[model samples]
Target chain A: MKIPTLHIPDGFISAPVSLLFLVISGFFVFLALRGAKKQLDEKVAPLAGLAAVFIFAMQMINFPVAAGTSGHLIGGALAAILIGPWAGVLAVTVVLIVQALVFADGGLTAIGLNVFIMSVLATLGAWYLFRFFQKIFPKNRIGFLTATAIASYLSVPISALGFTFQFALGGTAAITLDKVLIAMVGVHSVIGIGEAIITVLTISAVLSVRKDLVFGASKLKVSLVR
Target chain B: MSTKRIVQIGLVLSLFVAAFVSFYASANPDGLEFVAEQVGFLDTAKDSATGSSPLADYGLTGFEDERLSVGIAGIIGVLLTAVISFGLFTLIKKR
Candidate 1:
């Protein structure tokens, strides 16, 4: 059986749209570098690398989420919570690049699209949502993990909407935009559950032994329930 | 645990997952692919330009064993990701 992945292949989107995203993605990458410089200290730098490695590894395991549909970790929220938003973007971007160039999982020309949706939008968007949720939650370990899970869950469908928007703009196929939106969002909502489970579990595991390493933990002033 | 120890252990777990556990991943289409197929635009997708690369599709070239093929590809992917990301982060970290 031919295994299907979420990495967008070529020909589905127009060249102009693809190039547009490429430039957009490049700009975000540049900003990430600048932001990472300030955010990544000596300790966080290695964790950033491990974040990329872990994301790459987890992406390979596509658990069955729905009938005939499997989903793997996007790791955007996990990255942002563990590392900072900027490094999180870079981590996921590096994984997408490797998957495209080496594994040929995604289209070469569509790197920008993939990066924009998964790397930029997912990571940055999740970071903000995480901060917001962390404030409103109980401010304990459970609240932290709960915030992570919610943000991570929403990130999947949010990124899926990003794809839909791009498809509306430059999709080559003669399909209705509404159909794409509903289907993309529907399946992704289910997949988002899987994303939430993996992300919360990973973050919880890290928090267990090394809460200090978690970037998001810095804001939660409450004592951890060790 | 120290940050170095955490990172070291994380890397080992990553390697283990990619190289061994990945072999058992479900073969069904992912959410996006399934949605695309269901929405009727899946036919518009084109093959990747680097489809002929030795490690294309996460399988090693000239390797027939399914387990070893994906496992080796996964290992290579993990290492490559580690090198590139680690180096990049090291360079960009605050001075």
Candidate 2:
């Protein structure tokens, strides 16, 4: 059996389209760097770095979701909850860049597309969704975990949809967009469940040990203190 | 535990996951790859530009044992990611 590639490979999307995403990804990275400035004080900087390292390591383990398909940690929701959203974006982007350059895990040419979907889209999607959920539910540990789980679950399908949109624009193959959309979303929905479980577990573990360090939980603490 | 100790524990956990547990990870195609195959676009994937790198596909070159090769690669990845990310975060960090 062939080893599964983690992210988009080269030649899957046209060069022009790929380059467009690269430019867009560059913009987001700039925004992330600037946004992370306020969030990355001395206390949080090391934890943010650790979050990136942990994400890189966890992404290596692909748990089987079904026959012939496996899923790994996207680390968007997990990162956002551990660090802030901006740092989460930077952290995951750093991982993706390292994977593409050193490990060749993701395509060098397709780095833009990969980062746009996995880093930008997933990170923002998870962050906002979690916030939305937090607003609706009680501001407790359970509520935070529930929000993280739900947001993590939804982020995968959102990313899948991002891929489908990219493919529709510059796909090298002749496959219909409808088929790609359905299949990508279908498989990733199950994968998202795994993502949710892992995200919840990791968040809970951190929350148990150090509530102050967790970005999501700390917000709740702030509200409770108020 | 203090923040320092917690960070230390997290680092150890990352190292353990990358260097040891990664070998037992599933070998099946990931969601995107599986979807591409099912939807008939799998053939469009070309070899990565860095396909010939020693660490390509998460395996170090010149190692006969697949486990050792991948394990070493994972450890290297973890270290590189930590160093680079820490540097970036520190650089951008507020004084």
lDDT by residue (A1-226, candidate 2, tens digit) is: 2235799999889999999999999999999998889776678788998999999999988999887899998999899878989999999999999988987777999999999998999999999999899889877777778888999999999999999989989999988789999999999999999999989998888777777888876665534221
Model 2 has an lDDT value of: 0.88
Best by lDDT: 1
What level of docking quality does candidate 1 show?
Answer: high
**Per-residue lDDT of model 1, residues B1-95, tens digit only:** 98999999999999999899999998999988888888889898888999998999888898888899999998999999999999999989887
The 0-to-1 C-alpha lDDT of every candidate, in the order given, reads 0.91, 0.88
Model 1 ranges off by over 4 Å: A1-3, A220-222
Interface DockQ per candidate: 0.83, 0.79
Native contacts matched by each model: 0.86, 0.84
TM-score of chain B of each: 0.97, 0.96
